[model samples]
Each structure stands twice: as C-alpha cells, then as structure tokens.
Target: MDPLGALQEPLFTVLETPVSWTEVLGFGSGALCVWLVARQHLANWAVGIANNLLFILLFTDAGLYADAGLQIVFIALACFGWWSWTHGGGPADRLPVRRTARHEWAWLLAAGAAGCAGLTLLLDRATDSTVPQWDALTTVLSLMATYGQCRKLVESWWIWIAADLVYIPLYAYKELYLTSLLYVGFLALCAAGLRSWRRDLVARIAVTA
Candidate 1:
C-alpha cells in the first residue's frame, strides 16, 4: 500500500454516493478558496467564508461535527483576516506578510495544545463522537493554522500542509474519496503557498530595510 494510494483500502460507505451537488460545489469553492489563499489575496476570505458555509452543511449531514464546527470558526477567521489585511497592524500598514512574533508563537502553541486536549476530553465524554481525539486535534490545529493565516504569517501554510496531509487520510478512512483527494491537492498547494509567501516576506523585509 503506497502512501499515495493509501486512501483506497477498505473504503468506507456511511454516505455512499459520490459526486453529489453538495460535494461537487464544495470541491469548486474549496479549490478556489485555496487558490486565493496561495496568492495571499485578501479576497480569499470571501471565498473562504462561502466555502465554510457550504462545508458546514455538508459536514453536519455527514456527521463530522468537528469539521463542521471548524468551518464555523473559519467564518470568523475569514472576516478577521480580511479586516486585518486591510487594517489593524501596529499603527500603520507595516504588517504585510510577516513571520509570527515570539510572543504570538508562545500563545499560539499554548492555546492550540490546550484547546485540542480540552476538546478531545469533552467530546469523548459528552458527544457520540467516533474519533473524538483525532477530530479534536484537527479542529485545534486548524484553528491555529487559520489564525496564522489571518495574520498573514508564512508559517500558516506549513501548519495547513501538516494538517491536510493527515486530513487526506482521515477523509479516506471515512470514504470521502474525492474530498480526500482534495485534501491531497490542498497539501501540495500549501507547500507552494509556503514557498511563495516566504519570498513575499523576504521582499517586504528588504523594502523596509
């Protein structure tokens, strides 16, 4: 079982049909959202917010509560990122495509870890969650990544790359093959976004110098 083909084995079937309207539209909006993010276009937020709404409907029906909840968060984050990109730096427009500050990194890590653990415990205890642990982790990690993106941090892309890599397989296990393949494609785009954003950061720094 090769890594690339790893999603094919023991394919699942809770929601059997593929290429439904919800999923097909999801694919289109999802791909556009990523493309806009890769270019660091602020308009990505608009597409992202729409994608989140679409996925919220889809994931809720599919019984992926965490994924659905994460989409809700993405809505807020998308609006936030849009505003931050437009304004709200420290006193000026000096906050274009920068690395995360040391203070921000510490809080980000602490918040992400605590959030994941807490969500896992709560879900495991309260909800009829099938994979409470994994779902919680993905939610928390995705929150961290979305926050990074909101700030235009180059590290955001790397964060997404890591999560989506795992997400690809997880979706496969749940037998959302086309969606799984979408995550695989997302992983590649995230890598590209990392490189592209790094270059933009360097250029921004040079100009400031």
Candidate 2:
C-alpha cells in the first residue's frame, strides 16, 4: 500500500470540498499539541510529532512541498524539545516560561528574514510553487517559533501567531480548506498560549525577586 494512500480517503465534506481523513487527523493532533503546550505539558512534543507526520502526507499531496518538507524539520525539533524540556531546566527539573532576550529577538528576526529570502528563491527556482513567498515566510517563522518554544520562551507564541495568520490563507488558496480552518483555530490558541506563558513568566519573575 502507498504511504500516502490513507491520506486520500475522504472523511467528510465541507461546502462541496472533500475533507480527507488525514486532514481531520492532522487537525485533531495539531490542536491537541498546541493546547498541551499552552498548558505547559511535556506531551505536546509527542503529539506535535504525530501532527507533523500527518501534515507531511497532507501537504505533499496538496503540492505544498515547502510545508511537507517543514514537517521533517518539525519532527526533529519536537524530539529535541521533548528532551530539552525534561533535562534543560532549573533545579526543579522542569522548564519554566521565560522572556526572550533582546539579543535573541534580534538574532531570530534576522534569521527569519534570511531564511525566508533564501527558501523563497529556492522554491521559485527549483519547484513549480506559485506561492513561494508565503510558504517560505510561514516555514521560516515556524522554525524560529519552534526553537523559541524549545527554550521555553514566552515570545514563541507571538511567532506562532504570525505563522498561523499566514498559513490560514495559504492553505485555503491551495484548496486545503480544512487545514486552513485548523490554522484559524491555531491563531486563537496561540493567543491563549501567549497569555498563559506570560502569566507563568510573571510568576517566575516574582518568585525570583
């Protein structure tokens, strides 16, 4: 059986749009992963890994090569995040939400700009991608956000919000409506995550003081 065959099976329909089982599954796992992360639960990484795998299949079928490729990097980052959250903590042995330093923000912004430019050029030249700029921007922002998340930075949620806003329209234009809706949900969840993490950061700082 083909690896992508399962992704082709229709789970439902939305306004004449066929929603695949893979997209439904991806939607569930992706929402769960973000929710868990908002609650500061370690299992978000594992759920995120499953979500990444599902999206790899979904995006590949949609001809979204950049997004499909991004899932691979997300998988690797998820693994590192899983381990880091468990061991790369303070004396409490659990990661705590913290503010991103100014210097780190500068580095992250520069890297995001550079990555988006390079990936957009590559996709434009190497693939038949029509929305290369949007794809590359979302992909690069996601990478920076994931890295920030691994460090338990409160700013990660902001980056996620930015990526989700771009992803929603991009997925819809690609005819992946369900995935687009998923990003809509992601946008709301990112706000919740930002609020939750900010609260945690404030509490941690108060304790330190």
Candidate 3:
C-alpha cells in the first residue's frame, strides 16, 4: 500500500464530511499548542511548529490556499517566537508579558485592515478561494496576533479571539469539522491566556512600581 494513501482515508465522518487522520492530528496538536501557550510554557513554540506544518497540509488540501499560506508564515513566526521566548528578554531569563499600548494597537489595527484588503483582492482575482474575505481577515489578524505573542504582549489573545470567531464559521462552511472544532477549543484557550497574561502583567507592574 502507498503510504500517502492513508492521507485521504477518513478516520470518521462528521456532518457528511470525511474527517481524515491528518485533520485529527492537526486538531490535536493545535489544541495542545494553544493550551501550552496559555500557561506561558517554552515548549509551546516547538509544538506550534508541528501544528503549523500539519495545518499547512490540511488547508492546502482543503483548497483554503490563503490559510495554507498563512501556515507557512506561521512556521516562520513560530521559529522566531521560539528564539524570542528563550533569549529576547535581556537578562530577565524570560520575556515578561505586557499589555499592548494604544499607539501599538493603532498601528496593528491599521496594518491588519490594509493586509486584509490586499489579500482579499489578491485571493479573489488570483485564486479560486471560496471565501476570500473572511479568509483574508482571519489570516491578517492572525499574523498580528502571532507577532504580539512573540513580543509577549497580552493583547494578542484579543486578536486571536477575533480571528477564531471568524474561523469557526468559515471552517464549518468548508466542512473542515475538525479544524472548526479546533477553533472552538482555541477560543477557550484564548480566554485562559488573556487571564493568565493579565495576571502576569499585573505582577510585573507591581514589581516595577
């Protein structure tokens, strides 16, 4: 038997859609990666690298080309995040979490909007993407969130939550039930992360004061 044959074999069926082993694996790793990140664990980046690769395959196979491309970007960001988390805190040993400032939020919002518009036009004209608008919105916002996460900014969770809300419905429409479910799990994890990071920020402020 060809080893690649199993890639298409359904591990189960959900809502008349075949849920493949690849999607299952992607969902599992994604959930674990998000949970670990919520706890501020250094290991999250390594797991996230694996998740990004798996998602790249899954989204590409599903014809979600924009998302597939986003995963490629995610892999690069994950690598940068791994290094930053390990060594980017000066002499503090770990990067401290901080709330995003108003000026930084303004820049991020503007960049996200511009990126979404550009990607939407590109995907609409250049690709056969099914849901270009929602896809582009999530992809650009996710890029911002990942960058914020790398810098240990507490507001990254807010961006992730916004992206996840859009992703859940979009994936469900695409019949990527497992990936949709993963986004649901991600919403819960984002909540946990926001709270955890907020506490960390509070303590840091107390210490500096």
The number of the candidate with the highest lDDT is 2
**Regions more than 4 Å wrong, model 2:** 1-3
Expressed as tens digits, the lDDT of each residue in 1-209 for candidate 1 is 56322322333333564444556567678888888988877778898888787777667666678888889888988888888887856436534788888999899899988998899998888778787888888888899999998888888887898789778888777666777878888888888888999998898779789
Question: Which residue pairs clash within candidate 3?
Answer: none
Candidate 1 structure lDDT: 0.79
Task: Supply every candidate's count of residue pairs whose N, Cα or C atoms clash at under 3 angstroms.
Answer: 0, 0, 0
Rank by lDDT, highest first: 2, 3, 1
TM-score per candidate, in order?
A: 0.87, 0.96, 0.95
RMSD of each: 7.2, 1.2, 1.3
Model 2 per-residue lDDT tens digits across residues 133-170: 99899899999999999999998998899889899989
How displaced is residue 40 in candidate 2, in Å?
0.7
RMSD of 2: 1.2
lDDT scores of the candidates, listed in order: 0.79, 0.91, 0.90
Q: Candidate 3 residues 1-209, lDDT tens each?
A: 76545766789999889998879989999999999999989899989988887777788888888999999899899889988888875447688888788999999989988999999999999999989998899899899999999999998999899999999999999999889999999999999999999998898789889
What is candidate 3's local distance difference test score? 0.90
Question: Which candidate gets the maximum TM-score versus the true structure?
Answer: 2
For residue 164, give model 3's deviation from the true position in Å: 0.7
